[model samples]
Target: MLGAIIGDIVGSRFEFNNHRSKAFDLFTDNCRITDDTIMTLAVASAIMEAEEQLESAAEIGDNNREYYRLVEVLAVKTMQNLGRSYPNYGYGDRFAQWLSSDQPKPYNSFGNGAAMRISPAGFAAKTETEARILSEVITRVSHNHPEGLKGAEATVMAIYMARNGADKQAIRDRINGYFYTLDFTIDGIRDTYRFNETCQETVPQAITAFLESTSFEDAIRTAISVGGDSDTLAAITGAIAEAYYGIPENIKEKALTYLDTNLQAIYEAWQEFKKKRSMNITFRPAKLQEREILFREGYREWPKNRTFEEYCSDNAKEDEYGIRYIMAIDDEILSSVILLELKSIMGKKVYGIGSVLTPQNHTGKGYATTLLRKCLQQIENNDPLIFLYSDINPAFYQRLSFRILPLEFQKVKKSTCMVRCRDENWEALLKSSVALIPDYF
Candidate 1:
């Protein structure tokens, strides 16, 4: 939601003094990321944290609503926590009260605050119904009014539609069919519009700004020029605009400068979470029926002298978890794979990473690095000395913290044996003569 945050910062200076025109500096020294930006990030953080918890939960039992309930709790608590840290960042009166209260309860108000921070709900949810539910969860914590909930749901649904490749007419039809009327244009509202905080008065105006604009910056300018609750209006408009136009890189970089460390950390974490979530890749072992496809794909990466049947016979076997850890896209197509072999050398556990392969198409996208990180984390818990033989690309493994053993200590002459061992385990692993697997190398 960089678009929404950029809009918030750009419009922050014009929130009170009505601009009434689009011709103005987008970024000024006076502009700052306000409650809209903080609370939007807070919503994203809460949703991500709730998702992680849901994934970690051993059992959902029978109550599927438990997932939404957990998200609701996190949304409310995280908003309050972040709000306290950014106490001076222009919160609405009712929201400010809710944030400070020991037993915080939602005030039945249809404030624009609900719509301004609901962008994350749109991005995180997989379906329209899920987006609606998440928006309601985030909105009702402070703005519990029906109009407030409607505004939040409509904003999120618009973003979800745009993100999923819906046209502007579809977004307009959906928003108008569900929540506020988009009967007015940004130009029509500019001269006469006054500062308004209620969702009914503000949400429609914000939608019109996005509907009439040609670019993301144009959308923010259109929202701000209307001169009614400028920051929140632009935030709501920019959320939709971002999904449609994709904010410019320079604008995103400039907007990030306005955020404090706390907000920046949450934004970065949310970005990383979104990136991983969007990969649509899974790590698993080859099934009995798909063994041939796996072998064919593996052969494409490393076309050695071995036949496909021989490759299948070799990698078809499994480790303790019965997984060869193939990183596959769409379950049938293999993008990368890592063969794991664990052994006991000199009374110490040792893990060997071998047969690391990523097809030509997926070579530079860090899929190998992703697998390496996952394998390293799994090994670190058991305190094993990890080693890998990278004959094809030693530099790639070296970049991932695998260090080459000294020439005097090297047992393999054809390939480099790089090891990643803890400082304490380094001396012990080096002292053992049997730790090096010459055949595997």
Candidate 2:
């Protein structure tokens, strides 16, 4: 959704005055938030509210139908409220009227607004079917036309696939197979494209702009360069690009300045909402009943000479600095790791992570990765330096932003040592000074 806002602000000035080339400044004084941004945020606000309401309803009984109904009502109310508050921001004639109407209803329109504002659905949904359902529920309050619903669903599907690790070709194939044919390319239509507001004309071009781009910035430029409904086109493109490439920190910081205080609060709340929703797995200290199970699992790593009873007895001994952490789902342990508070080195606190393991059945399901990520988030503060030694490929830890140390700096010979520092200065200090390898791990 931040991607959608960035595209809207960058493309706002170009919507009227078309810049046919990609070489141009991304942000300028002339740029401003438009209806595309307002509507996108409105949809996001609706999703957050709807989810909260659904949770309350779920506590009572089954709320499948109630969830969809809440989204529909909240989307209408939120869009109308925000739209009226920012009436000067470029809304279409019918939509503007709907915003101020005493009793608003779907106008059966096929406007590109549907696609531009529907990116939140893609990010919130857990499955392809849920994506379509969310898109329809949020869209039909105004864009009840078949083409409008189709445009929104296509955009949501692209974002869903991108965020879930689908490659560009796979996303393109899915969009092409289910929604749009996507027969035309951005280069082929750049010179001939004209200002248009219909979903049929806009969604395909926006998606093509994303498909051909190499990065998030390039995607925004590509969409604006095509010369038609620039803000809406780029908003659609940017949403997918964000899901695929992720936004750079610099770009994200600059984009937030365009939003007002109210909108900024909404954006911050959405960030927190997403974090809470994504980390659904429980992370806690292992229970007494699970200790024997974990001990048996840990014994597999060093079964050469130690018997099961010996290993269990050794592990049961209490250590002052060591604590066992586990990731579980409904009382079933999925992954486990031991965290050690090592002695500080050069006045800097150091932590060690070891014995990371996931059951064979849960190996490929990302349980271990989730556990490690949660652990990092919980302990990255307090000016601590975290280290891990991986007997497997170092690339897996690298993806979590852990930097691999040199051979001479490794805690153990032939073992890949990785460090997650608090910042650049901490990393520089670690690199320049002696390596602090914990004796326990």
Candidate 3:
């Protein structure tokens, strides 16, 4: 739940006394992702087939201690990274105690801590039912109470609905449908929030905030407006809302400002982790595999196309097409761009690879070769016939399994090459340059 961490970090400042509304900021100088974000990631990382992490931890390395030690290491590292020098965000009393502890002592405090901190289960769950089950199982680690378990379950449900493309009403219905045992209406929460303090009351209330939202940011505002555990409430709601609306551009830009340099990098790490995780996940060990092999292939003469370098670097942050990649060195940008959207070409059933660039001085380094091989390695299924057109050297792509075809091959329906690279294909020539994004204003 990277989105939740971002929300928590951004909303931490306004948690208790929220004044600003609908403002897009990564994290206000005062804001930082809390135990919710850290614990959520840990839970997502710890998942195994055995019905429980504690059980799995107990059975590790022919003994249980290794697993516990591993879990403790992850928790400590995540919590340590949450402080000032890294992400530098907010944390409540019980969490601070856990963070400061050299070893994790199961604390029985069943506050919203368990619920507010669990969003990754939504992403990790294979189905809605599985998500709810995982939510209950994981929350029991520290928060054994029914309310604690309920709060975590509700967060998982919200995250699952949002990621699966459910609208606000759909999310609300799913949340309310399962949480019928609790007084779950927005009005009910707002009316009784003055007296509600436990996980049961707060979790559903936070989710309702998202369920009633019009925009991603609106969910956070709704959570804060109700006023109970404002930051934690918004953290849960904002995370689900972000998955629904997809983080707004202005908000993403501003949020990065509040984080120190290390955590700013952590944002990139989170993106990479999620991207690779989605690509690699399968049911059994026999299915587990790494499909893609991406290489940056750093540049020496980066200034030859300085603007292109900056542009490619900026576009790399949002691999929107899910197949686009850029070349960079250290923090400085570079001059290679390959933004190929791996979709089919109508009738021909050919795999398309249009985003190809070999700008100025960077030409001889075999970027095309490097990128092509990497792309092929990444394809485990579906993208069978790779296509591209190159007159300068058909031999280059030919080495990478691409074949040269006649100009009229477009009309011939061949499934071989990745692209029918036309001389007029200026959009494909440069990186990050899109000639046709129909309604993109």
The number of the candidate with the highest lDDT is 2
Candidate 2, 1-441: lDDT as tens digits? 999999999999999899998999999999999999999999999989988876752221122667778888999999989998899998999999999998999999999999999999888775455677889989999999999999999999889777765556556777887788988888899999999999989999998999999999999999999998898999999999999899999999999999999999989998988887656567899888888888888888755489999887777763346788998876888899888788877577788887788887666545576577667656655567778888877887765556787656766675787776645545565567444555435
Ten residues in a row with the worst lDDT in model 1? Answer: 56-65
Computed on alpha carbons, the lDDT of every model, listed in order, comes to 0.77, 0.83, 0.53
Which pairs of residues collide in candidate 1?
none
Worst 10 residues of 2 by lDDT: 56-65
The deviation in Å at residue 101 for candidate 2 is 1.0
Q: lDDT at 249 for candidate 2?
A: 96
Q: What is the TM-score of each candidate against the true structure?
A: 0.64, 0.66, 0.51
After superposition, the stretches of candidate 3 with alpha carbons farther than 4 Å from their true spots are 18-90, 133-137, 167-170, 180-192, 195-197, 280-441
Give lDDT tens digits, candidate 3, residues 190-293: 64565344787677777777767788777766676676566677778877887777877777776666555665565555566566444532211111121111
After TM-score superposition, what is the CA distance of residue 329 in candidate 1 from its true location, in Å? 3.7
lDDT of 1 by residue, 1-441 (tens): 878898899989998887988899999899998999989988998888887887843222223588789888999889989899889999877789989999998889898899999999888765555777888877888789999998888889888767755556546766776687788787776778899998989888888899889899999988888997999999999999998789899899989999878778888998998787667677665565665665677776666678877776676563342345666667744344555556665556777787676666555444565565555655655656667776777877654556787776676677788876555666766665643543452
